[model samples]
Target chain A: MKKYLSIIVVSLFVLSSGIAFAYDGSLIDDTSYTGTITKIDRGARVIELTTKFEKTPKTWKLNMQDECQIQVMTTKDPSERGAFKKFAELKEGTLVNVYGWPKDGKWLARKISILNPDDYMVKRLEADAKAGVFFGHEP
Target chain B: MNKKGFLALILAVLFLAGTAEARKTEITPADQRDWQVIAPQDSDTPLRDYAMLYEAGGHDGNIGVIGIPSMKPYRYIKMGVDMHNFPFSGSNAGNNNGTPDGKYLWVSDKGADAVIELNLQTGFAERILANPKPFGIHHSAAMSPNGKYIFLTGELSGKMAKMRVADGATTVIDVPPAPSAPDYPDASKDGKYVFSGNYYHSAVMVFSQDPFKFIKEIPVGKNPHGTNFLPTNRWAVVCDKLSATQSVIDVRQLKVHRVIPVGAGPLHNQPDNFGKYNYISSFVSDSTCKVDLGRMQMVDEFPIHYRVGHNSIAPDNHYYVSQNKFSTGLFNPTGIVFAINFEEQDIDELSPTYGKTVKIVPINGEPHEGRQIFSTTIQRWNTGTGGDLFAKGYELGDVKVNFDEKVPGKGLTKRPSLEPIHLAAAKRYFIPRDDGKPGVTQEGDVTVVRVKAFSYGYIPRFIHVKKGAKVRIILTNIDKAAGLTKNPDVTMGFLPAGYYGQKTRLDGVRGMSAVGEFVADMAGEFEFYCQQFCGPLHLEMRGTFFVDPPGGTASLSVGDYDEISKLEYQVSDPSEREFITGGNRLLNTLKEGNEPAL
Candidate 1:
């Protein structure tokens, strides 16, 4: 009975690990934002985005780490997991929620999730309000 | 008037008149005439040497030939036009470097999947090689050192094509695998191997030219864009755009020799005439740096305008031109968009004006790539050097689409109709769905819409999708079948106002289709339109992309024309004083001949 229990536990751990790294892998304890990609330097693998979190539209240059996890949402549900994609597939004008941390005085992207068009309106407005685009909505 | 002696004058007046007539007839010598005074070249204004700048046309689909020093337009080579055997546009230039002999130039027209050969001596297209499908979207046309073959990169196909120049026979080679976008391809100086920069990965892929097989991948910085082989034949430099560095590869050993740090976005690499110094153009950093090949270290850096896309060193090593990608706020705002400029800097160390910007030449379109050739190589119209294009039996007007063995049936005048296929795919959108929303249907998980693009407009002008639904747009260009626009290369993009990005843009050739899928995250109306300039009504080639709120549908009814008329009148409000006097008050005062108040 003891051996069987240990085997079951090991199986559970392996399955979870597989799921975690299935669509690339994300860094632990990183801040995330949903923004529109404004510019891209394909050679540098860096992107300039206007995040919805600021009071004004602030351009943020985020460099993708070599091991950064990238996924694209394939379903209408924002929470649904999507397929893995290469860094070259990411194009300008894409709406994405990026998880990143500050490293070496630069924004290092850990994971990038291309957002679904269905959720764009709410997120865009939320970003607009945070950017203080509306009167009396200053933050 | 010399009625000199008014009375004695009857005879004297006649003599005076005759003398005046003679004086008027007497002319100055032709050589002594004082024409428009142009400053002559002196010690301070030494006459510069001559060179020809061949710039790849970004949107205009023409190669601009400009004369150096004079800063004058020489002529333009039209690509993928009626002038060429293969008629198309939206030319995405690969490399502007002429053949080894400098007799021909190879450029890629991505829209047509054809690489055009331009005769440098004749200024006319010599041939068009339609690289077969699955080897499409050719980006670079790097000619071999022997000038016998041209290597090309298919960005979307993830493949590299090697075409024999003599017979135009093309052989497709797989790059690596999916996720590998081979961007710039170049042949080794010794012509033994070919190298391609993998845009997706941080490595350069090498292939043996003789056997045309993959050799190995050399690890480098991320997003290696351009690979330039030095004249030394022992070393090659790869611009790692994303890594902000350049990697030097030892061609003899086929390994990375050094990775030198550079400014952000090192895009293109150009070696000076002697191959001692390499010029790296940092696009995002808006600067260009010179690296000493011996030490593999940057020696000097010069600041340039915003976003230099491509740079070229003069053949004589006297000047450097940085082709800035953007001109926003750099020049006078004339309400016109796409105004670009390139800066020319003196690089000669012995010159007193070295390191100074010699000229800032404004161009109409973007300079995708540029090559500087010594003036002695090609004869110019100013020199009346060689056989003119007209003398070679080239027509000024559009030639009839001709079929050739090199590219069979590629220049077809009529394209097959895709209407039946489009209509069938669009049927699902018109039928009421389970949710009672017409023109929107959820298939399993995502909502799909089929759209057809023609000249000046898109079918189903309004595309409505529910908020929170994933939307996939499949766009097809029917311009060739519709025969509406003369130029049929149309790209439709789902772009909202002030939004930047070409990710959603679907580029298509006539009778070709493209697909773009994304989540419908935003609610409210966006716009979809032809991104490429097609004709006079290009701006009108737009439609509404409506994202309705969840469980709510947008009102698509125009109701009546009277309602729009009333709305327009209500907004006009002619009673406002500003409406009647809309001209600038200062301009009005000036027109009345009054000094305007400060």
Candidate 2:
């Protein structure tokens, strides 16, 4: 399998500002997104999942950017989640679920669920991302 | 090498197309304000095209209404500045103070040793000879409540320049130079007493034109930088930068009331939300501490950013500090405004926990003044919390810092103490943009990629996504000035905001670009933030992303001016936002080969 990546540049401009609150119609309603995680970046506290929505399973990302905001979930022990500070720890095959929308451009996750990372299927994808090959983890 | 090189080249193209940036723009009478999150073209300014204050969810799963939170949250218009065009000079801008009418911006240029009057309405820039002979005009240009006299500090020249505003005349009052005089040559409200900080002389010089003579000098700490008079002319406050202490001097008596050890490097400040408690900024630790004027003791402190030499308190308690010299947070306007809450924690006087401590919280509000990337830190601090901090309902922080500074002085004067605000703020805010919708999209192909650049402190911002073919994003915060992050191994650049609680770690001192690349595995919106205690709005530092449909959305043309202008990049009302921000030569050049040229 082949893997590819894209890079985007960023910049800024100066303007005489006058109440610059642009509109907010693009964001998907928080309740609209539903999916299950296929991976988690523990150190980054970000989880990727193929969610099973009421209509369809959507793929997305979830995170508690600040660790203090990361509530200790009963499903994942705080120690095991220790990797929340190091993204490499989340591994490719972690089974997780998420609910979020397209904020900015990518998925801006709002809710997430951590399925048992021990799930055998998850380990498979983990092996794939590491092997730098195609990891069929999509739901 | 041949096979891998080919694939690598292609991947590089996709990766190159996915970088995110912050651009703060406005709309024309053409209406509409949908924020468009576009990747910054390779240009000089950064953070102006992306969104800011991107919290992943702190409000019980509700991040600070970051750019229209109700929808898919892709395009959010933010507030920031063009760092490349910043009114830069080696000297700090004394750009503080607006006219009593609040219509004009007073650009205090410390380096030029002059005041530049910026007519917001006309966009005209003019210089005013505010003072004379100060090599480093630190700041402290006090406008009379009546706008009659403008009292300013001559930082290096070691003098105070007092100007009579009523007649457009500047009279350089050769006040007796303190050991380190005129850190900020500001005056007391009553107009009867003029106070200036003697940073080098370590003293407070006091005088008023009524007598035209140096009345008294109060001895203070190592290098008192800022001086402000409590609304009541009876007292004056001084902030010592080097030693991180504040001194209170009896205005009439011309005597030192009490010198208290506040935060690390107390530089600029404001009053509490209610204007009763004075909140001062601690530069080195990047913390803002508060003082209960009544009790006269250092109560608490909150973390902000480093080398925050300038600050302002809104008419409300929310305070702001300019991210000076530091590139990452350099040109951010809303990024500078820090909401603060200060309260007296009861403690037994002698015990470690006995003395009362102050608390500071940053806030998010509409940048009331035109988004000039710079808000004054001299807002009047009130002691009362006014209301719940940060969230909209509460009273907004009352501190407003104005820059257009230049004043004339009489023949003689003395100096005063230096210290800035009270404490407890929401976090940090960098740039702002409208939360617009995703651009034209193809139906099927989708891949996710993350770009993790620059990692510092805790709270490393990561972008995660389903790993197929879309351009997913995962960003790393290398800005050490982000005050919200914590790490014992990193030495952060916030002392005035008091980041000392998190000892200086080896990783704390890093340039703006930290890790540089971490791809998202999924195709979705990604979130990022500063993982260390950078400065005032550290927590507010955030950027969002979008993973293109796997095949990548092909555009009609890259350099079509009309298409680029009308394509609705990241703003809903492209015309309106463009009218205010379109003159950007940099924006045009960066997008020259990519987006249509405006």
Candidate 3:
């Protein structure tokens, strides 16, 4: 019975250790490159990598047309359920530094520094239009 | 069938046919109620259907709501770009503005040094936040819970940010380093805890409150970049690019708990909404590892979605993974995003072993009253890139009723005095068209046909009205924000596909107003459509309208479309042969939009 219990415990430990320890080792500076932004409307919400390369330094308009993705990793209030909702309420000009690859015209953000965005506004945001066409309702 | 069986079928069909026929000709629900004065149906064309010339600056202004069937359906995606202040006022947009809660997209104009609000639903600007601190505001913004605030990060300015609606002012959370990092700061709840992994400083900093007073700075792996918190809010997974290590921190304890070595390092680490899991992505092998929270280990690894620039999930638990951007032909575009579902691994819905596949059927011509169904490029699939319609089918001027191999037919022979019987139809398909423009393409099988009411989305909510009440409506396909359309013309409104999705003032002091057709003359229920393809539920868009007679109930078969059209022509200028030609053309268009060979 003692031996069986030991075997069962050992198997549980093995099964639970599904996570592999990842110690990222990059001596090289991944400061910059170029790629397209896969998802753009993060506002100040950053993602991990840029998705495309337009191959230029000119300022690209970040809209739904442009692909941009930003990853955000931060501690929570331990209570709030919707983080995106919190991100949406941020004031303009909350600043941050960004390190990324630039391909074509857009940038695939590699690294970002959250800052005071007082002077900064959401880059490319617009309201959508819809027509309320239904039964028995008037324009 | 058999004689009695056939007769029974015919009787049932006829009864159902009577119900169906009555649906089109019956007076609107609002016109049938007691103490309600239902307006008479005018013989003249609807105000929205007629072209008008105005005096804009007294220079003969012309803005006409062109005539297209008001009763068909369409789909589209509309992004907002404020063209209201553009050099050409009328040329830049489709007219009208929207609220911040309405715009579902984000874009940064590096040139104007401004971050404007764009409408992905109609390709128009609802609002604009101008004169950014740095002349180079790129695409960056994050929303807090309940859409109260937004966070904007920029490279030119060195301040960690919060975007509040009041005064559009900025309250500095932290002083970020120069050249501003390429990424944006993601907020926890209520912008309480904002974070930025300063690559220059080689550390990740956590903030507290709105102004962002630093609580503690953790010395993470080299280039402590790409950080995210598990949905559980228990751990903060920081991806350090230099050491190829994911430094895990116990956010609650605010301490460096452990460091995990990810082979080839991680380009990104993502947390699920539940925050119980995190995905570490590797750009090199194009693979990802699923991290287990309990054991602090990598459990499973899978190939990336594509050249995998980034990935996300919809609220419905569907994954939207984007691939590399396009470069002519040699390269696939970043605009190519895929709808993937890996965790829902059961491939048995209808057939135990067969999984569901994406269907892209085209529109085949159908004949209605007089409308002619023609195969046009407008029926192609439309999305953001303008032209990526890989499917085809027969769609119409209104409802996107696309047929598969079989065309649906009906017993159109009219009759009276039959009891009302409803027909149950098998689910079919429709490919909606949004005026076939460059930016809008209404996709899928859901189609909205114009009824004399104001409504959209699924048909769960209804607006009851009285019969014979005059109502005007402007129908537009709205599928962009809902991710259902891919039409350029419909999205951009180059032709006749633009619309304003709103209900007329229910209690206004104009001709007549009420919350809905609540004062219905007759008592009955009616189906409504969102008309625009907002998403999978777009097809289910419908509503009910009740009209009660003077202390009576709504009966079957009132003066509906079939009856009204017949009555309308009687008052028309039948004396002129040319009038008949014009009427014939209109009738042909209607017939073509509906009838199909059985």
Over the stretch B1-598, how does candidate 1's per-residue lDDT look in tens digits? 5555666767778889999999887764632453322222111222443566777764445677776645556776665411101101101111122212234676665433455666565576545454543343566667654345667776655677766654455667778867566767777644467888886667899987665667888989987977877643447799987788989887767899889999887888777633456888887667888886645688788888756777776644557888775565668744323456788877755455566676776775445667776554454444653334223322111121112223322222321111101011111111211122234457889897767666667767888887677776666555652233233233333232111111244544443456566666545444454544443334346666776776776432211212221221111223221211111111112121121100
Q: Which ten residues in a row have the lowest lDDT in candidate 2 chain A?
A: A65-74
TM-score of chain A of each: 0.60, 0.34, 0.24
| Per-residue C-alpha lDDT of model 2 across residues B1-598, encoded as one tens digit per residue | 6999999998987776554212224343323332231332111123221111121111111112111101112221211110000111111101222212222334343222334333221223322332222122323355543344455655433555554442234444445643344656555543356677765567878766443347777787777766766542435678876676788777656888778888776766554211235667675675557676645687666555333434443221222333221322323333222222122221212223322222222323211111111112112225554221212211112212233333222111211111101111112222222122222222355332222223222332332233333331212224333333232222222111011101111112332211112222323332222333344333233433333335443121211223222322222233323212111112212111121100
Per residue, candidate 3 scores C-alpha lDDT tens digits across B65-112 of 111112111221121211111111100000010011111233332222
Query: Model 3: residues >4 Å from true position, as ranges?
Result: A1-139, B1-113, B120-123, B135-139, B172-182, B214-216, B263-265, B318-322, B325-598
Task: Give the per-residue lDDT of model 1 (tens digit) for A32-106.
Answer: 444689999988989887764334444678887654545553235322333456677778888776654454567
Tens-place lDDT digits, model 2, residues A23-139:
211122221222344776665666665643122234555553221111111122323220111233334654443322333444443223244444322343345335432211110
Interface RMSD list for the candidates: 25.5, 24.9, 21.9
Off by over 4 Å in 2: A1-139, B1-99, B130-140, B177-180, B273-275, B305-307, B318-598
Score every model by TM-score.
0.49, 0.35, 0.33
**Candidate 2: share of reference interface contacts reproduced:** 0.00
RMSD of each: 28.0, 33.0, 31.7
